[model samples]
Target: MPNPSTPEFAVVCRFQGLFPKDIGGYEKHRTRNGGDLGHVDPTRSHLNRPVIGKADWAARTIALIEDMKAENFADEIETLTRRRRKKQIKERMAEGPRDPWRATRHGPMREVILTANRDWFDALPTAAAREARAQAFEDAARDWLLENFGGDVVHARADLDEQAFHIHAVIVPKVQVELNGTKRWMLQPSKHELIKDYEAAQDSVGAHFAPLGLKRGERRAEAVRKARQAGEEPPAYRQHVRTADWRKAEDTRIVETRAELDRRTEAVTAEEVALEQKQEAVTGREKAIGAREDAAMAKEKEAGAVLAVGQGLAAGALDIEDRDGTPALIETPEAKSGLLSKLRARMARSSSGRARALHVFSKALARLREKARDEAKTAVARDTAEIQSADETIVEIASRLPYAERRSIGKIRVSLSARIMALTGRDTSRKTPAKGEDDESP
Candidate 1:
């Protein structure tokens, strides 16, 4: 039998700063019995204690969900949503009798999530080596946080030894004093939000440090000021100084190198802006030409259809006069009775020996009219199909273009139906198709 795969290791890190005022009463109402909230376990202890005593954990998790919804962090939500059932402790307390001290006991706190793939690191460095690496990463991470977020890092600890190598940190923001001398930590809106910003900043600064073999947070402020005076962007200034430090004998070379890089970056940014403006101009002109082509095509088809119908009507080939003074144009039950009248008029106008000729001719006229109507209907159908095919082509073309220039030409069904109706002899004052009607090309 194959050896079982190593069981996945799990680690958790949490921080507790303060408790709310009505926390004790809430715990009493929350627990099956009076006990420390953090010591309870349903699987073994079951003494009415919570696995995590910090009520702020439940509150902050809810706040994280709201923030995720605002920032549209959909990738992280699956992990967050699964933990909702574990968050029912707050709901259970809210059902209890009102307590005046609830707000005091349930204050805000910082929360962060960090994890590593333990399987990759299972080659196992010595304890001393692992600690050194962890400390180095932590120090690098902290320096990044201070520069961007302005906070004093308070604590860092691993969650689990066997499974995942992860750290949890608690940071107190720089204290700001009021005009009256009261002081408080500058509020961090969300722990997850802060952690993400820190991670992104580190990635940016760390990548810059790696190629030159320079450690992060090493460049002095004076070098940056001089480079800035020479018109370097902040990141480029630091890069130049770090590269010079690595070379150690090239002070003169560093100045010229930094100046050249800055010039190149400015040129690239200007080129990109110009290209975007030119693209926009080209798109605008193409759209104008397309709109004109569509209008002309529609107008041309309309003129052809009118010409076909007018020629047919002028020939009087389908027109019939009835003996009862009725025209064969009106379509109704009363008008259909005039069909017999139309037949009698034909016989009266026929030769005396050719009485049956009128009946034969009347039948032939009915057949001819039906044929003409069918042909007209088929012509409209063919045009409709062509129009629909054209619409699909337009959509396919627009999809490949950039978003700002991808103007909608409307749906093939609605627009094609309207255009086809206009080309044929039908009303098109509505947007939706008639019930049970297939949307074909014009």
Candidate 2:
């Protein structure tokens, strides 16, 4: 059988700073837990300490760290410190080959590793910072691997050991490394030589740190600006650069939205106030209408009372129609009693005509009716005689009434004059002097 082709891999290195031993609790904690967890807490006593160079040997090397396996695993130090081995070797061992040609490590055993200085570790903010630093290291490490190792590289896992944050990556080689016209062994690189080559590659790409710290949106905008500057189509990395223009646009949008919200709020407030005022106005109008209706009802009641009082006096005149639509005769019981009492008085006073009280009353009413007719004629004559004086007064007073009321009064006055003429058996045409006769020069 031919020697198996070597698995392509990248290596990473990391470091952490240490304080002097006289620090009391710090040293003890460091010794107890190993330095994987940095010295952020003093009371906790044990900050995790990391082990060195466990990238390849992490499965077995975990037991050799400062704490027991359970405590170390409890803190997830293995996950944090282990480098990604792109392929699972144990899984390969599990599946017994059905066909001898198909069983080869060349297919999937990709792996990579990374290393960094203690300054980088201290530069991290907190646990979150540590995570970000790890990710950055992976990304940088992968890029280096692809550029130098000539295969697509992806980080599979990470582990922290002693001072270094290390990663394991998988590589799917596009073109195999040619060693004097033969495939080189993938997993056979000398450990010392691998570290040296990895360091040299990492030093070549140092500018990505600040950009990595930026927010994703900022990174994208920076990429756009760079693309514009270069006068070329934006590269895929443009999506990673954060720039100021995007943030400025976002701020402008926020400010505009706030202003619009304030303006709408003001408009809504104004509308509410206006609606309240309208409601108040409607309430006032309703109250005024109610008052007018109340006054009209009161007037009707007073008129009814007055009609009860004077109705008897005008009873004999019942046969007559007044200017208003009401009859002169008393229509109510109170008015009837009054008319009968007056009739009795007239009968008591007249000796010979005692029994003819009704006739007397009839005669009196007839005379009074005639006199009223004459008086009405004279009143009309007087008004006609002084037409110039009355005209303005009538017009002004009539104008004060509504048009319908004014028309009603005119109709009543005309009907009354016509009725009086018919009762007196007089010709209406000749009863009154002509209009200009009162003003004649004769």
Candidate 3:
């Protein structure tokens, strides 16, 4: 027997295909209730009630059904009827059931309602607190569907104005799956699969809410099985058979658990705030380091440019002319002296002697130019070596910084991921990278 006071987590699923005549009745039940025009105080009726205005019924309802369109699930069936004879059969099937008033071949949709015991919300002191709790439960439940059903949930609404706060989620059972190496869509899920999925979701919801002092309640089927295993007589009303003494004991345990949970929640909230502050400080420091690195790189580039200009000037092939402010060639002292001697010898000889002197002067100038080029190449190589050595020293100094500084980068990434998981209640391990993300390792 389970205590009534302890919150019970329950998930109920039902498949529905509305017939022509049933459509009006179903719509009336969901939107309005009681007599034809609907009751003003419909909440008083235990059977049907007015839905909470805050519930996102339109959005939730849309989520449940939009995926079950014919285009998505009709491929497999359509492929089988590609031949002429089979095409005829497909046309007949498209005509639908002989009874026009009934549902189509795949039916309309399925409804899943996830709920917690009334005591869960009743225990909350404020309406705001209760609403937050309800919203959290609904979000968890929606995530459960997305995980197991591959995003089949189309519509979902939470009704707070009813007897209990519960979520009504509509789901299209269709899913794309790989079978025998072939990918195809399935329209219906097996009963075994649905039951197993529900059980898993039940466990998930229990774990998610445990930190808030909501424990998992025993199910009647599970209780009966345990009783049979122990060779004990099962109670007549297995679902509602908690004794006074058991209830009292469970209530005491819950109170103690709630107190502990509150303390832990407060501690965790404080820790989260501190972690966020640390993360921000780390980010600021990283940005400052990046700026310093950029400045250093800019200085290195400037030094390289200056070295190139100096090498060009030293080569004597480049000279800054004051008149035009442009580079002009400059002759070495030896070359200038040799040219003057050739000019003097040209006047003391025949035309052939003058030609010979002119050739000698040109040879001297060529040799001087070649010598200047060699000196420029040597200087460039030396400067490059020195620059490489400086780079290595800088890298070594960076690596030798305190271990805490190096570890801060990794810690920031880990903490950011943890915070995201805490807020969303999502498993970080299962998250898929967005499109265009590289799959290669760093």
Candidate 4:
């Protein structure tokens, strides 16, 4: 009873499930004239009466049930429904534990109980006055039940012999539900729950008697909601129970749960702090990387600006790769400074006589290609360091040549177009010197 609590004087309306088989015994208990009623005081047992029903509880219940069955044609529908369920159970057996109707049974009809605490009645001046006030409470509760549950409410009776005046009712709700496109009637108590959700059901009985100044008791739901919103550990729910042992056990459980909640909240706080610090560290690293990228781009811009100003890069493509030892058609669009500086140093190193001899060697390379044009490839192992050195010298001379001749000039020749073919040993890269542009004699 953590929710829908009734104050000591307020109305307490509650419903319980009553299965079809248990109806007979319950009807006997409600309609009994004077046999041993468990919680009833033997001296006041005669005080119980059918305050709201047309007859005794059992007789009224039987009449209403008959009327409902005849009006809704329940027998034929129940027969067909059973046959279909049986067929389905048989057909789905191959699916093992997945049969839909395997454990399915009928839900119980509704048995509602409404009452107030005995202290309110005791505080009254006279027994007659208590009876009148109890009558008022009973009338209001009966009216509320009839209004909500309609003709489905079978019987209502008053028990004055109990600790407090209370009303007992049985409502067998005949609900219309559609299954597989066909609509039919069934006794289902849960339909009332759909009509009024849990919280509203709890509020209804108390609100009906609000003019009497009686109030609903406190519950834990609202407090739990606020706690979650504030990011705090919620308080454990404490159920209202009568037995001392049950209440003590629930209290113990709540205490243990509160301790567990506090521990979990502290751990979550620590994790959030660690996560925040990690995110800050990652942000710092990203900023450092961005700064380095910005610096590299700025350096490239400064060097390219100087090259554009000093060299005639805007006028022609400057051959940058040939000035380095690597023979390539690549130009220095941004690194023209490196190419200009390196070429000046290397050309200054070559003597005048040496430059002339290197120029003659370049002419000799062209003649070699012409001579080997028709010669068949021979298996020759060569060590051509002098040829490679001569190739470098020719590149220095080509720096002074025009752009087309510069591209066509160097990567000077070896002896013949004999590719390196080592059949026994490990083979190296083919170093066959290519034919020059002027020696295309084929």
Highest TM-score model number:
4
**lDDT for each residue of candidate 4 in 1-442, tens digit (9 for 90 to 100):** 2235533456566656565555677766665543335566768768887745566556655555566545444443454476777665554444332111112243347677877777876667898888888888877877888888878777788888778888888777776666555454556666786233545676776788766556564545677888999999988875433223454677789999998999999899999889989988999998999999977765555444434322433334433233344333234555556665654444344344224433443355446655775242321223344434655566566666776666555432222112212331324355433333233211
**Greater-TM-score candidate between 1 and 3:** 3
Order of candidate numbers by TM-score, starting with the best: 4, 3, 2, 1
Evaluated against the true structure, the overall lDDT of model 2 is: 0.44
Tens digits of lDDT, candidate 3, 218-263: 4555666788999997656623211233456677899999999999
Candidate 3 segments exceeding 4 Å error? 1-27, 33-109, 176-186, 191-194, 227-442
Q: For candidate 1, write residues 1-442 as lDDT tens digits.
A: 3225634322222223322333343334244255332323434333222222244543443343344333332222333355553454355335432211114222343333233344423434686666555455445444444454453343334433224444444443323323223222233323434343433433455453333232233334555666789997654422222111334446457778888989998999899889999988999999999999987765555444433323333444334435563233312333344553543344334233132333444455668888999998998889768766775666566566554445333354456566677878677785443333233311
Which 10-residue span in candidate 4 carries the lowest summed lDDT? 95-104
TM-score of each: 0.21, 0.22, 0.36, 0.43
Q: Is candidate 1 or candidate 4 better by lDDT?
A: 4
Question: Which has the greatest lDDT?
Answer: 4
lDDT of 1: 0.44
- Model 4: residue 401 alpha-carbon error in angstroms: 99
Which scores higher on lDDT, 3 or 4? Answer: 4
Where model 4 places Cα greater than 4 Å from the true spot, the runs are: 1-8, 32-36, 56-106, 193-196, 230-442
Global lDDT of each candidate: 0.44, 0.44, 0.51, 0.59
Worst 10 residues of 1 by lDDT: 97-106
For residue 266, what is the lDDT in candidate 1? 91
